[model samples]
Target: MYLDMPIDRATPHVVRESVDAVRRWEPRCEVVRVIPSITESRETIRVQWRLADGVIRETEVPR
Candidate 1:
C-alpha cells in the first residue's frame, strides 16, 4: 500500500487487510484492533492481539 496516499483513501482498507492477513496466518492469535498512525512521518500500522494462551502483543508494521 502507498503511504503517500491520503489516509482516508487507503489507510482504512490497508489496516483491515493487514489485520486479516495476520489473523489468517497466525490462527493462535485473536485480533483486537488495527490502527493506522498517519500522524507520524512514516505511517505505521499497529496490530494488537491476544494469543490463545492470553499473551498480549502489539506490533508496528511500516507501510
Candidate 2:
C-alpha cells in the first residue's frame, strides 16, 4: 500500500505508530516502502507508505 501524509515534527513518530497499529490489526500485511516529503515553504510533512497488498495509505501532519 501507499500512504501520503503532510510534513510535521511528529510525522516520523506518527508514521511509525500507524505502521505498528496496522501490523497489530493485520499481522499478515507487510510494508514495502516509506517515502517522506517536506515542502520548502510549508510547515507540513507528507508521508507515503507502500504495502504488499498493492494498496496505498496517506497521512498529513501539520505544524
Per-model lDDT: 0.81, 0.56
**Best-performing candidate as measured by lDDT:** 1
Candidate 2: tens digits of C-alpha lDDT, residues 1-63: 223443464557655766677578866556544445556644443445456666866655654
Please, what are the lDDT tens digits per residue for candidate 1 over residues 9-63?
8877898788789878988889988878876456788888998788878999877
Between which residue pairs do clashes occur in model 1? none
The TM-score between candidate 2 and the true structure equals 0.43
Where is model 2 poorest over a 10-residue stretch in terms of lDDT?
1-10
TM-scores of all predicted structures: 0.78, 0.43
User: Which whole-number lDDT from 0 to 100 does residue 31 have in model 2?
Assistant: 52
Residue-level lDDT for 28 in candidate 2: 58
